[model samples]
Target chain A: MSSHPLDTALKLAPSASAAGHYTGQSSPAYWNMVGPFGGTTAATLLEAVLRHPDLLGEPLSLTVNYAGAVSAGEFEVQAQPVRTNRSTQHWVITQLQKDADGQPVVCTTATAVTAARRETWSVSDAPMPQVPPPEEVPRLDLARAVEWINRYEMRPVAGVIPQQWDGSGDSSLSQLWMRDQPPRPLDFCALAAMADIFFPRVWLRRATRVPAGTVSITTYFHVGLAELAATGPGYLLGQARAQEFRNGFFDQTAQLWNQAGQLLVSTHQVVYFKE
Target chain B: MSSHPLDTALKLAPSASAAGHYTGQSSPAYWNMVGPFGGTTAATLLEAVLRHPDLLGEPLSLTVNYAGAVSAGEFEVQAQPVRTNRSTQHWVITQLQKDADGQPVVCTTATAVTAARRETWSVSDAPMPQVPPPEEVPRLDLARAVEWINRYEMRPVAGVIPQQWDGSGDSSLSQLWMRDQPPRPLDFCALAAMADIFFPRVWLRRATRVPAGTVSITTYFHVGLAELAATGPGYLLGQARAQEFRNGFFDQTAQLWNQAGQLLVSTHQVVYFKE
Candidate 1:
């Protein structure tokens, strides 16, 4: 069933919203399959607008504009708040037909603004890479090139892996410890589902494959954090360089953290080189 | 103008039945800012039903999801047509605002589809790359930056180029052959106004100074040739590579052409990597 509803919305479920909101209380293994990315439908509509009970814990900063193509089957979601202020609370979501046409696709439209938590405030940090462990590294099938980031849960740190059976794929720009293996609670839509899992370091640094739509991307959020708690593991320190493809535009930049480093967010994009 | 009027109507201009459906009399700079992006508004109205006048020039494969922030002031654009097949034609666009109490707050919604363009097709002819001589280069000044992309009169077969320059840096890949230096016609909402001209190649490839919305951008618009008539000179090729940064998400790919090598449409985004 299209790869078993994406492996039941990517396994790892002890109780992370119990893998809910693929609609109909999840678990047919997430309706099993057809077309579900644009960051997994904006992280399943931010868990359907944070399971609104007037938006439970709040603290949202949702922004989705992945217009069209959800197609897997069984779809329906709704979140509405228009506007509210004590600090900030705005929401609007509507998906409706997983597509072929039940008709109703917006896919993503998020806005979360909340402020009022001061014991003192003012502390910016993230720069701590020195790793190892995750059951001693090893496990990255690479199939479907990790399907826009196999719905989270990655582990690799020991002598760094994925050298693809020893041919040594030349991988190093270290830092690993990611979460969502099943706990769920990390928000900002799991950093928009791990920013579409950095497309295999654009051909593992200098191997060259080139050609995939001008690749244009943008993510800018001044300072608004909170919603990351698979609890205990998550860190990704990496780097890459190629600053020029010329004339049609191709760009890059990256940084991510959380293993207890306390600086968890940074990204880059500009891919649109079509011929 | 702190920046709002529905963020300046996504860059204003609509009517004449939306500029007589994209094939004639266009340009107040494409009715004001459809290129050179930064707080502009309107056009999530699926470009008035995929350029309806019964669809023009035919060729479709689209993607646009810019979920929220969409604010500068005053907004309204709805656009519909979820299905229309016979080859194809799909549409959905929403950009709303009410917040202060009026209610609705959807701000940015997209979904576009339109087909029919027989070629039997295979792809790629490539060509176009021999820099120099757009009136002999040199004209990228902008009082320090921002002449609104020099009002569509671009000229870069590598002139006015500077990926890094203190004394004048050019770190690797740089291709510029721009158009409309008065010749007019930038076409297709001016390619989303140069899709965030990507911070001058992240400040001339780190010859130092980095700051542009941290990061998180995702864009994919495969193929849809033509519609770029800088009239005389036009070409923008700025490429970069700094292989993927884990967890937080980072990736790059860039390209945009017109000086006749052809390859007209391409764009991808996923940015917001705060460092």
Candidate 2:
């Protein structure tokens, strides 16, 4: 077994006869205050589709919904390709586990689209923000209250966690340089988890650490395997911000760029918050 | 039967026996060059859930994936609430239509979350762009080649459909004031359709009218039904821009605000483009 915590966390064993069903376990290495880190869960779902025998091409888009809280233990994941076109494929994935009554319950639901990409007219209209390189920026050592926070090394460029939770925060923008703590190779699964690496926008926007969790997150992958492989284990520049917060909910959008300035993934998430 | 095009397009009749199944027909009033307008299709799926007897609260987030080209004529939708909590519910929806072989095939898949929202600490960090009021801006008369273009009234504030196709355009930002024509009151369904009002960013960015369509879209509702109802039948300020375009796929983020500058809806979409 690989020693990487992420690898162990994402390990899945295929069902004996079922084509698309696999069982996996939650990793304590990536545990959050409530449950497993959502990023890791999202990555694990994508991992299932990537490992599926019927997968058509590289992943282009993924949307995952946290239907309910997942309990620690073994869980079953179903990644079935519902539609397969000449150049694209669509998949619906579900993560289910048993409840106290031993009845199977869904904890997460997701949809992903993979496509055989072709070279096209490409442009980077949203330029990488000019910022200090990761080497120059000092690494932020957040209080390791959450186990997941210790898995990634983050260099905060701005919008660090509020020192004074006095609700004086005026902006929700946060920019940071982040990568796996042990520096694993950059891949789809790693990128997916990294997309959700930033702290919840609500916490930063209000500077009030109220209860918050991601309800739904959608990520669009701009590059394919070749581009990602070329990136290796480099640090990714991540920037996130919230547009509006109202009625106990807010949405945040984020972008991740490689050190070479290639935009890798763009993600948007809606989060439930309690004031 | 309702005479309003939107109402007609969204009309659904419950299945005789199935709890979450409904049957509906496509309307020519909202037809595009290829198939029915995607936005209307998305709203129709949401409508099924809203009309479902087991529905819990107003919509908070919706993610729709266009799995295949939906054929015209009768289509069936299934909106199943997978999990319902005290304050939130998670739903999975699918749209299917009979293929040429008379076999039902999936065309679109969607997931939605509805919640009973409570008053909370709210703020609009992303302010609505200042622009001329709808009364001050003249309505744009698009060459109505596509039938759906005539369904709404649009006034371009910036980045109108490019006048030249010579690839001289530099940016992919579009700001406009738009609303349903014949003046219909704004609702979740109307807001859902309007979220996709902007032209694909590729056309405006490269000034090359390439074939493009949205593959997946996710919309987050920051306000509840009461806030939407208060807006009445007024023009919404809509602005959209693409952050990155690469390898035949690009993502765009948009925001819709009421006339009062209250952010009503925020949406993100990934589009497939051909060179």
Candidate 3:
């Protein structure tokens, strides 16, 4: 598949970076070899793209098929303009990581079905969720190296961030004010990472402390809408439902809506339990 | 990883069968090499799982990752009992197919999360979408000779079936009386396949002449309760929202609910298109 000149050129291009520290790029430890699942890696890569200005304003559908087991490695976003449209652009973004062969492993080659931003007729007229603002909500730092979470500065509007070893059970539902540290413009990829983080908040809504469940989430991104720039105190309401929790695995569904009350993105996760 | 003595035995057990007449295999046409965006074959495999009796109670969350680009051969699923509760059973299903070694490819595994039927608790409900009775809807026999749709019978309430292919781009909503020709216990797997088929019906609703849409559906399966059995007429309501569509890919959410108004299952799908 890589036997073309463009492929060679694409391979040699420098990696894209968001440059602005607004979007936090968390520590490397969390992304390497810790979890065997591909979802974590995909989420991490999405952040990398979100920070990179070159990849902004594009809609991407990242279908990360767990291609066997992937090893611990660093990844970069390599997107190139193949065609541009008045309203849309077709481009490719590849997750580049060195395979065991010392050769690069294209963890994923996604075709971003991007388009030029259009004036949305949506007024986002709905009121924010009837919850306390972040200034009122207590802030608690997690013990884990905030690799991905580091990019987005999150202030809980309701509860504290649970530690990895925290035995205290918390409600599955959570409200928070999330913003890039430097206030960078968020892209489609960033919205995905935001949606992915909501399931934990939902878990907090239920119990005081929960046995962190392992669930596989598959997201189908439809439209490209930036959330970081949405009007308001700049927070998206995220709510999750512990839909089913039987067997050793449970499923959770989460939805993210901007301040104006339009559904921005939704996510579904299936988790494995420890107990 | 095969640590238990029963591991090998579990691996050898034949996968449970659904309602289809053919039990052991699927056509190679839906192979990824045939098309990275190939979806119908996967749809058929899903159909077989739906009809398989042993898989009846087991819940399904099938995510066709990477548009399933490389189909070396049929990826088959076989189940193993993990745990059983008074209310629900826990089953983990392993999908088997050949790897590049011509050896078995270790496809992703999914565990069914089902809750046991319980006494009445706090109740919240959503009314079933209103539509014509199943007997009033038209039929579409879009089954392939070697494929799977023929395994069951569908009676659409508002429009014609795909087999008829009467071109009409009207609405993307329809109701149906769907059941196996030889009736079987309605279960989670069946509901999954129903969600799969009903998705196309949404497009069918808009078909004034022929269904005109090419798509790759992304779906999220909700925990299903066998709530439909009590319906006197036993007809099912399948509804879909063309949630969002842009840049050639669109997403629609679908569900299968019984006549009693009990919600059976919820599904979300993202389909890609050009033609």
Candidate 4:
């Protein structure tokens, strides 16, 4: 069997001397307008943690900070378990890139909490949105312009896409169906990436694509391996909206749910935007 | 003029020798059921960044990870700018505690993004909920059980407080009016703490207070100094709800809005809870 493009993009090689350090090369297949897509970078960092020797249980929460520009080239990642309790573990991961001066600069910083989950009384307050099935919705046709957009099939059920920026909308909510183009099995890494796949909230609310980028994003996973495997290679409903957009920044809150109405992840991100 | 209890609790003395390290002593006034309240700990961490010599503009985003227990005593904090761009700066701050064996253990890890705000197209999609004025709302009386409760006055407008938990509600929403006791002026540090003031969503949804604690929290500040100052010791509206609760964990998303219906901060957190 051939390797998935995403797997090939996120594949990391360990350093011979360092235990928690890794080297990975950027992939043009997942390229965004600038550098690489933020979602792919988030997935790669979580992948580092998942592949760590000292990793504990599954990821409960993950936060990624896009500190600097990630140049398209080879980069290094350092993942370490900063603290470990009986059942929970905390990790700090950093993505480093060498500048023109050959000095290593931190491009991204992430903190992940992993713990062994136990059976408990479960409740979901945010009900799944009533929308048509993926088979009925038409896929967005952006495979020609955005490389990353081609990696996934997106079908919008509510709100307009960012490309349709006409500067006339007040609502920033977007509900859609999304999944890998090639139908890869659902997992924590892919879910982390999917959490960031929404367009900037400002773009949806203002209808103008001013300079905007996500400064930081946080995702909380509410499912385990069994639940994820049950999802298989299918579309997951995604909903995102902005609460406020002001003073050069805005916050986007989103949720990803499986077809079975199981909430997989809840994510929040702060984006930097300019007029 | 005397300093406010919150200001005193967040105050840190810079180390004469170390550039980015500081010493802080936890305050009993802000103590929770166990040690210091997680909100105050988050504020102290942000305070360290604010006091740093190399500090940049206001905070755009902040993520705090509760890695371990924060003992009630003096602790050390290290805040360093890992990446500095022309318009943005990224910092990594860690709260360190020495174990009985004198080895350093990571208690909390935080990442902060600070940047200069420029003119931008701003819009708020979330409308502030209509609630009674602060004078009309009665303050929750829980000063005897939680010391931190005494530091702030909270008036619930939506969900029931944990003390009133009778396991009767299926909704996890909570909207309340909150402000520092004695009416202290509003600022980023205060807003940061206020973001986490809401009770865990599980407590409101299940109506039972099991063993629950915040594992990680991320807050995005949408307003600048002027907007915060305009809020000026006045009561701010806080709204929080859980998206999903499953397998020993739950996630809370919250927002803080001024009396004028201006949104100030958006926050999200994952909590560890037992059945």
Candidate 5:
């Protein structure tokens, strides 16, 4: 069996001297217009913490801050388990690369919480939006300009990407069914990346493709490891929309539901846009 | 005129020795059942960054992780500007206090982005929910068990706090009109605090007030400083609801709109709950 591109992209090696330091390289397969896809970077950061020796349990929440763009080369990640309680653990992570002058550059910063989940009274207030099954929807056949777009099989249901950039767009909402191209089993790391797979809301709301990138993203995992394992490699229903866009900034809120209509993760991101 | 209690609670004194370190004390006016209100803590952290000499612009987004419960006493906050771009600045902040053995303890970790906002193409997709105006609604008169409740006057319209703990709550949605008791002008700090001024959804969903508290919260400010100044001290509309509650955690998303029905901020949080 060959290693999946995602697995190869996320592979990390621990430093012998430092406890929390690990080194990894950016993959050309996940390259975006500017840098590696933000979702891939987010997944790599969470993977660093998930592989920590002192990890408590599954991830409950993860926040990734893209302080600066990552260069295509080797980078070091420091994932420190700052605090650990009986049932929960807190981690602080940083991705750093050396500049031309040999000074350390901060590419990203993140915080994650891991907890030992226990069964309790569970309820889902927001049910999955009614949409056609993935089998009925046709696969999206857009021109994959960015390399990262080829890694996912997307079936857009509503609010599809505007075909013409004529500045006549009205809605920012997008609902779709998506899964890994090679059908990898769902896990915390993959789920974190999938949470950010949607296009920028500004691009969807307006016909013009203004320059926009996410500044920060936060994802809350709604289920434990068992639920994710049960989900297998099935497609997830994703829906995202922007509430307001003003002053060169807008926020997008998104949700992912499993094939069984179980809410898996809900993520929010604020993007910086230029007029 | 004397200073408003909200301002008094957020007062910070910069340390002469450290560049980005400040000292502050918890205020009795905003005390919760366990510690000082989380909203006040968030506001204080943001205020520290806003007060920095090298501060660039207004806050665009903020994420605060409650690593541990804060005690009622003096705490030190370290707010560092880790990265600075042409129109945006990234900040990392931490709150610390001495433990029983006089060692520093981490209570909270946060990341914020401040941007020099410029005029841009904007839109409001999610309009304010239709409801009675603040003038027509009666002021809510619930018992003030927590001291923080007395600081804000809330007029709930729908999905108000449960009248009985019979687990009859079929909806976790809550809509209300709220303002500071002394009517402090709306600003980034006040708006950040107001974004979190909602009860835990678990308690609202079920009659039994099982122990619940916020673990992490991220707020995205959609408007600029000028709009907040224009809002003045008028009441703002707030709506919040739980998307799902499973295992030992649940996530809540909320929005705040001014009296003119302009969306100001949208916030999200994950809470830890006991069965």
Candidate 6:
């Protein structure tokens, strides 16, 4: 398989100042309406930790906070292993950039937990949603969409798109079959990117698309490396729904499932919106 | 009403070193099986941010990473406002302690997003689970439970407790009605504590109570300050379920709702467990 643009965009090199710190540059290919795609940013942050020499096991949970805007420039990331237990390790990461005033500012903050796994009692309560096979569904045509939107091939399986809303539904539930446009190997970075691939819930509930963006997102990975490699580059089922929308903020919870009906990642995020 | 112990436990004194720094002492009344209860530590971290001199709006989301065990003595916390936008502000908090070698260690790391709210389109999709009212349900007797379990009055509504497990079910789901034991007023601290009050999901699914604890927890608060105060000391319904459990870890997604069937907070956590 050919190398994907995402790999090049997320590439990072060691920084001279710190051992676990690295410097990365943004790519125009993944630009969103405001800044770089949140998914790619999340993926890059996770990458910083995954590349750490002291890293242990796989990612169990990751939380990312979009503290500030990211301009099109170079940014420095510091990933540190705060504590490492016998079977688990915790990490803290920060993405820093110079503000217009030339002062250092934090643009993003993340915490991730990595732990070794042992076979134990297992079960899945959330069942995979019933949807037509990927071959039967039509791929979303995003010729005029943002550069980041064009990076994913999405096919809606449930709920109507914003433009197709008839103003009849009160719930903001959406299910789609999505994967990397140019099929990349399944790994932590790709799965992290897919966790934030869902559109804001507000767009699914309201006909008019008001300004909305995710403020904070937390994802819990269920599968390990073996399961991810088994799934390969096939399409994964994705589902998202809003639990509550109050005032100017709403909370969205989503799940990404492999084609074999195994849950891979579950994510939750709070978004800001305007009427 | 008199002051609740929870308030005294979460109280903080300003640190002389920095504007957003504080010195806090852990309370023995809230100790868990390990060190301090994770919920109280989470509440203390949020308290640090809420008590900041330059605080803005209410908390929309908070994620806390339990990096290491916190001793029962004293700890230093630094809560910095990393970024403040027009309507939103982001904070990064860290709890520091001295290790055996007298070096500074990070016991917990957290990121929170606070924002001002304006009236907008609102809806709730996750309906309150059907169960007996708080008055109808019997409060659990935890005379032999951990010190922290005595801090709240919890009444189970779904899934059997570990002792009640008949070795017949495979799914892990638990719903309960809970609140402060002495009827403390509803606020962000108490609500944050309640989010982690549920027993580990592994205990609920398996008859054996293995060693388990939360590694990371992220909560999204849907209501503002006024709504929290208006709800007062009333009982709040809480429900938690595991989506997938494998290896030595599992993830639990939970929700807290008011008596009016309004969703107040949605939380997710990844737990560490051993057989």
State the local distance difference test value for candidate 3. Answer: 0.44
Docking quality tier of candidate 4? high
Expressed as tens digits, the lDDT of each residue in A99-201 for candidate 2 is 9899999999999999999998899987889999999999988775699989999999999989899989989999999999889989999999999988889
lDDT of 4 by residue, B1-275 (tens): 89999988998988775888998998899998777999999999999999998988999999999998788888899999998888899999999988889887899999999998987767788889889998899888874568888899898888857666688767889999999997998999999999999877888788887889999999999888899888999999999988898999999988899999998988999999987
CA lDDT, candidate 3, residue B138: 70
Q: Mark the regions of model 6 whose C-alpha exceeds 4 Å error after superposition.
A: B164-166
**lDDT, candidate 1, at B236:** 54
- Which whole-number lDDT from 0 to 100 does residue B128 have in model 2? 90
Ranking by lDDT: 2, 5, 4, 6, 3, 1
lDDT of 6 by residue, B1-275 (tens): 65688998898999899898898888788999778899999999999999998998888899998888899888899999988988889998999988779888889998899888888878888989889999999888866878988888888888747666555556688889998988888999888889998888888777667788888999999998778887899999999998888888888999999988889999999888886
lDDT (10s digit) by residue, model 5, range A1-275: 89888898899999775888999998798898888999999999999998888889889999999988999999999999888888888888999999999998899999999999999999999899999999999998868479998999999999888899998888999999999888999988889999999999999899789899999999999998788999999999999999989979899999999989999999999998889
lDDT (C-alpha) at residue A73 in model 3: 38
Per-prediction DockQ? 0.02, 0.86, 0.09, 0.87, 0.85, 0.81
Model 1 has an lDDT value of 0.41
Better of 2 and 6 by TM-score: 2
Provide the lowest-lDDT 10-residue window in model 6 chain A. A160-169
lDDT of model 1 at position A32: 17
Better of 4 and 6 by DockQ: 4
TM per candidate comes to 0.29, 0.99, 0.52, 0.98, 0.99, 0.97
Q: lDDT tens string, model 1, B163-275?
A: 44463433424465544335434444345444435443333433434333312223323234433433233555533332222222233334555555445544434332323
Model 1 off-target regions past 4 Å?
A: A1-5, A8-73, A76-95, A98-176, A179-275, B1-198, B206-275
**Per-residue error at B186 for model 3, in Å?**
5.4
lDDT of each: 0.41, 0.92, 0.44, 0.90, 0.92, 0.88
